[model samples]
Target: MAAATHAAAGRVSGASTSELGAAPRPAPPAIQRVRRRRRPSGEAPPLPRHLATSGKLWLALSGVVLAVWAVVFVTDSIAYVDVADTRILQAVAEVRSDPLTQVAEVAGGLATSGAIHVIWLVNLVVLVLVRRWRHLFVWLVTGLVVVNLTAVAAAMLQRPRPFEVEIIGRWSGFSMPSLPVTVLATFLVSTLYALVPAGRPREIGKWVVCALLAATAASRLYLAQDHPTDVVTSVVLGVAVPLAAFRLLTPNEVYPVRYRRGRPAHLDVTGARGAAIVRALQDQLGVVATKVAPFALSGSGGSTPLRITVRAHPSAAAEESCVFGKLYAATHVHSDRWYKLGRTLLYGRLEDEKPYHSVRRLVQYEDYVLRVLWDAGLPVPHPMGIVEITPEREYLLVAEFVQDAVEIGDAEIDDAIIDQGLSVVRRLWEIGMAHRDIKPANLLVRDGTLFLIDPAFAEVRPSPWRQAVDLANMMLVLALRTDAARVYARARKQFSDEEIAEAFAATRGLTMPSQLRRMIRAQGRDLHGEFLALLPYQLPPVPIQRWTLRRVGLSLITVAGLALAVAVGVDLVGSPL
Candidate 1:
């Protein structure tokens, strides 16, 4: 984490301001803070960044790689650098022997073009099959950049391989940055990050790869095929560049590279992300959160759900309070866009499901809506302002976590509960807005009061048909806990026969939230059918499959894209370097 943290307000070197020449007139607030805590000692990450410690370390490594490369590149022009490189090569040549030559031959053969190509194809094809677009993109991009940079650097430097030395190992091309070694390193990184799981597996993978790389570099040096500088720079650029790129682009915390498929990309709520969340709430929202853990993840899809326990807000308060937080990252933003795209294809011009541009925009809209609802005195949770975790990449949406409440589906419903649930939609109708998603999971029951949560799908001034779907979904959820006839009888108190009929008419399969639909399937209940029977007269079910030119175009584009991605995965093979 690269955030500024104020230390305990103690003078350094046991000196007071009076003793240290008036403390140099107190540095400007920002500068003073920076001076007090120059190191990223206790700060949480992604803070006005430098992001995570790993990110900073990688950046520093890349800088060192470039600096060393500069020195090696100038070895031919500079006296001392040339002397050092020549001496090292001479010393390596002194140890040449038949046994070592054979060993070099074997080590050189280990990282072959065929092996690189095979590993490359395997990662590409597997990532495609598992729909790991984020990993695949980073893998491909990192490979392309490293390989191209290797070629460019070699050509520009044009340093012939270890001048005036006998070459015992097979080699080609100018060898300032060792093209074979570069490609080997690139593929090793790609394999480890894309195929291996994170944590201990990857940590162990690093040491294993280090041994392999060291052996390969040693073989090249022993064979006198590359300058020591050549192999050194190669390993640095090859390993460090891609390592940094993968860490920054596809952080394991957000996008872990695993074999299991179809699980939602929920961020792990421990380690750096957890500590960052605690600090973010304190720095941004001024709440001292003691613990933050994932809460009811199975019910959430758009963002990682969290239950935050905070300390007292006022001195009078003794017990801690738990607030709910939705941690939205780039993954959730992609999910939102895909969800909206599917909605657009299924129902054209629904006038509600529009894709946001970035994670910030997504969190901003939710926070804004939450604030609006709370201001309007709706039953939704009161939102604490968004806490930025990684600039625009991640954010936390804090709000009231209803204590001792169960999903309306699990709760025992009463007449008042049903009426309150129904009236929530009615109130939205009166306010010219729509809850959009009226599933049981989104509705909660505490005592007799019904609370609405997860308005990520809610819309302002939605179409009457969309609002009708909301009402129908709500009524179905209510009927799931009680009888449909009773729910209908109570619904008539607020909704007229024609309006209720319109809502049921607009409602059908796929119109209801998937959670509600799945619940219905699990319960083996025909709640929708029962409600339709109780209506005054059956209206023809509104057509849900809206076939428009936009839908047709998007469908064609999507199919074409999928086919293209798979085709590329299958056939996008090339020489290792």
Candidate 2:
């Protein structure tokens, strides 16, 4: 019995040991599962790889291009090529000698008249309405800046006109870079920049436009308005300035996205927080803002002088910050107080705090117009930020201001001013843009320089009706401010009576006094005035000719068929009889 009990105890103990060994051990302290990280799908694209990797290469290439152009320019300046001169003189001699040439010249002259300018101006108005203000502003500002710069340069250079040159019409001033050539070249470049983007179409369009511009420049040389070197230099500067400006000002990213179904898309700002945006802009533009005593202006919103000044920094450059701010404020604000404040501050008050509604609307329109101009790489204020002052009351736009500037009206409109103004208007018309509000107030004269401003009411598409209105408005403004007859005479020298009439018609609403209309009518009755009237009325004859020929051909064919039918009927009736 004792042996059996001991065996049973051993068996039970062995079974208990086996059961302990079979039980699962607690899992080795689990290692946390590692997860792969990923970036958000909507993250902004990083800086372009080419720009990042080959920055020095790009700089080197730019330098090379400039160097090549400079070498070519210097070579041309030292040695005069008379190819254009000889060809032109020959053509002019032919015109004088041959009756056909004279007839052709008259026809061409009639064809040109003021029709082209009117058409171009009308087109510009349409573009402006379509929100292409940037393009218009850029073209106008560029032309103005170029003309002023060229005038100053011409004055400085004071190069004499070609000796033994045939006296054709009237010629004056020192001609190195021909004003017409420069104007034409610059105008073409600005227009191309405005119309074409960097793409296949742009590439093709640029080539065609450039060819046309070259032909135009050559024609100026043929007309003896400029030397070859002058034309070449003008072309070089024309191409260079806008290209550099475009590179500097135009952002790589698409902006002012087309409104979807007429609804404005929210601006895609890199920094949404206001304080951060301000700081970032300040850092980027080298602006120093010092608080000045708050002062109330006569208009609406109270004005506080921020005393915002710009200084050139090691990293950042000083540009027109105040002007940029003003533009921004004008564009972003919906409140009457801010709009009134901006306009009042810029133009100042005429009556005791009364808002100039026309001026106010003009300012707002200019805000939109300036955007198109800035984008097109024309000379204007560099925009920084739009400041909304209180959610409902006021807003301040920050821009770079033109320092040490004077108004064009501060002094008499000299021949130089008239020439510069005409050149500017011509270029704007060429690009299908019009500075509808062309007045002395809008013309900023800084250091004998003319800068066109207040393009809010401007248009950017082809419309003779609108252009005529713009012209009439400008004429009226000039008449009211300065010597009406002198202004009219100067205008008549460049624009025909028809163009003036069309402009008057387009802006007929601008006539504050019926007396102005009567004055225009009386002037239009004169022989010279009648010639002017004929200018804008001469629309392209090609379309009308084509339509007329088509109709005549169709009528002749119908008459011939009717005759044949009658003969056949007569023959059949005789046979039956």
Candidate 3:
């Protein structure tokens, strides 16, 4: 597990006196009393071991390759003065009239000024439009440096073209490192660097790009346009330039995650920005002259909410004052635009996708629901307040921290704990609400008490089917975490057989959260099989429903968006470059 951290007061160290202005107002007694004297250390947890190892290895390998290439290029340049390099060029010149010359000429065409410039221009435009500033910088700088280096090396070496030996292709300029090969190779490799996802895609892309580069280099050499050494130099430049640039410009993470219009791109909730968020909370609380300390916890990786623990200045009463805050920001996901569009077209009439809903609405809804649950005497995290970090970009919801709590997956669950967990669901049902997301992570156990947290997906007065889903998910999650027979036997204490039947029935269309899916997969537990083994009833397979207006509309919209994406892709492909 990789962890990055920021201390509340660390950023103030080098600030001017004016910048270290007065802190926010003191919080209320209830809020202030929970402040803790001890703070989490500022040290960041080492990045995931694999990521750190791979990054160091990648940089080391790139440096070695670049050095070797540089040595080879310099050696070849010096050797050319004695026609030692020309001997190799002269041998390649003998094959100029072969049919392979045409193939080589066509391969060389991919590196023409028009093709190179067009591809570069289109890629640049896409980068700018998508606001990929770091990638944009890297792409632009790598291209400029590679091109200028190629030109300078060519001019300095003044390696003559192979025309002296009856080279077949029409070509000009001195070529020690073939300019066309250099340009095309860099362009292809750089594009792959920018777009390829990690894991298998990256591995496959690397091989494919290498093959293309090898073919291009071989063709340029066989066609007698550039010397064999020139092509080799180009291949080396192609690999080294982009690798070096990305190392310098990109984040240290093996796979850096990007989000849009959220907390500042560089600021995680645990850093100086977190301190600012505390100030914002103070403003909301109308408290003046209070210090806030925030400790960020590891969030669900990628686009989920940001979670942090904040402690305000202690009050005279000295109550343990720690508040848990969850933040929602517009994350930049590759599928977000299409997902949003599809959501709009399909379920525009029915807005149930709370996770992907607007930040303001999501925060407000969760905060309200938490308050409702807390006020109703349910075992839930107490709602503190809500803060708007940015109008639509980011928002935070503060709640009472469940002291000494651990996720159920980390807890020693027994029959009593299972019953306590069921009580929470029963209480929610009694209060006419349903917590749509009930899983191990959401259930906290402390001192034999169970508390439910993060009811952002809960619904007031939900349909019977929705309530059944809540029960089913809760029971399924509980069963997976603890003993299935024990959970089933315990569940019978509070829930009727009919209700259990309804719970299983409602699971037919239940869309399991990603976290639960991962847990199920990791544990190698078959949920449906377990359910049947426990109950041993034939669950009638529900008929697949026909497309409703929402489904149809969303389908059409998705198809249209994909079509538009394809058309844009075609235009990009077909456009002159």
Candidate 4:
């Protein structure tokens, strides 16, 4: 009936009867789709508050107690005298015949010198297997220090071991903190760490270790080999020293637990490898660097590679000093291979990109290229020498730092600056080379001369298209920073109207350097409109075939890599034989 009435009304209103007669369609069902959370790259979970502060408090408290104990031991103060040793020894002597005492004696005997040595060997093997270098270092150093400090403390106090019961085998040293108790506690802590990774397993392992530690400390007191106070102090030192050392040495970002150690080091300027490079530079370059410091930026403003500045004293007789160094490392270099491969799969080809082959080789190649440019009298940083930290893992390039130079992007760009930048492009092209990464950051102005900084992207006998990219990139950088009219005007002086058009045309399907692309995207304002407006001719956008032969080849390579990875995994896991 409603349909009939609706049809009559539609006829009256000159609407189609078919629409009115049609059955009303049911509403689409709502979907309860699940969405996974996405965190920004390199983001880490926030450290818990207790983990951030607890270690320090524990360290301070233990340190204060130890200090008070040391003062009493040293000054022979009447307060808190050696009565603890007598009382504890008397208590333990009464329990000498108990079954628990016999059990503790057996356990203590098992935790002897031989057993402790075996435990250390086992811990070492586990740490090596897991590649826990940082943990291994902290474990070894803390153990050695604790042992020595305990010995020193016992000797200084000249405390005597308890004689209330049958003495443990070969006991001669004075007992301030029980050596066996200290060794057991520290060994348990370090051993559990090396054996288990963080998770439920580790949490359970930690509790087990804590129980073992308490038992071992109690055993020392039960056997009356040391006073109750001695065992208590030994346990405190064993735990506290490593905790303090961890807090001091390890970064909180790497580990959630404040005093947790054994994280890979973030190789920064202050690391062992970095210091070695600096020393190598001094020897090879024959210039003693009075001081080496990290420059706040050394890049184009975006997160490019990091460079270090060194203040070198050329001669002992001279007071004259100079700043000279190189842009050596970037955070990307650490994971460059995987990053480059992922990018290749997404984007067609990264031809101008650094060799995804290996970081050391890439760095070495850059050093070599910089030397070549310097030898050719091209305006670049004067090459000092290459510091090989690791043969195939790490490297450092030493070069003359342009002391009073300013980035082209930061500088007051004018017609003169634009002209000079263009001239750099032209000169490179004339010499059968291309500064493939012709970006504003790479171009620096010092004393009215434009000097190129990172020539890592330079290529010899490059294709005509590669040379054209250099031209377009130089123009693009200038146009983005300043007005296009000024750039176009300056460009016209060196390049013809048609030649300028050709340069812009060549950028159609060109693979831009990552740094240049990043800088352009990060710009607050777009320059493409201004660029088009200032163009002498409208060139058609070059059509890029998404699924070309190159892409197909890359796809096959990716498949092979995945297959090989699977095969290696199968081999590692083994068949269910």
**What is the clash tally of candidate 4?**
1
Question: Could you tell me every candidate's TM-score relative to the true structure?
Answer: 0.81, 0.32, 0.54, 0.51
Model 3 scores a TM of: 0.54
lDDT of each: 0.75, 0.45, 0.61, 0.60
Per-residue CA lDDT of model 1 for 199-293, tens digit only, reads: 89989998988888988888888888788877777777777777777777777777877665345557788887898888778766667788899
Q: In lDDT terms, which candidate is top?
A: 1
CA-only RMSD, every prediction:
14.9, 35.9, 16.6, 22.9
**Candidate 3: residue 286 lDDT (0-100):** 40
- Cα lDDT of model 4 by residue, 1-577, tens digit: 6576445434433422222221111111111112323334564321211234656776776788788787876787723455656666676667676677678866676347766766766776767676655666677766676666666777777777765456543455777767767776677766655455545776798788777777766677676667777777777777777766654443332322212432232233444444655555554444444455555343433212334444423333445344444433332253454455556567655455443465566677777788776665567777666654444444556666665778777777766667667766666665678877777678777656667777766888887667877887888787767877788777655555555665666674245555566667788545555556777576665433345576678789989976874554333223110
Q: Assess the local accuracy of residue 100 in candidate 3 as a C-alpha lDDT between 0 and 100.
A: 74
lDDT tens digits by residue: candidate 2, 1-577: 6576456435533332112211111111111112322324663212211232233444455466456546755676533435554455566545553554344334323113143344335535654666654455555555556667777767766666654556342346776655555555555565555655544666787788677665565445444555656666666665666554444333222223232333111222232223332443344333443222121111112122232433333343443223223312222332334444434444343122233343244344456666665554343454444443222222334544555555554555554455445444544554567665565555554544455554544677745544554455555544433554666666655554545545544443232223444444555533224323444443322111123353455457757966874554333222210
Per-candidate clashes come to 2, 52, 11, 1
Please write out the lDDT profile of model 3 over residues 145-201, one tens digit for every residue: 677777777887686776455566657688766777877777887777676654467
Which regions of candidate 4 fall more than 4 Å away from where they truly are? Answer: 1-266, 296-323, 327-334, 350-360, 508-510, 513-524, 542-553, 556-577
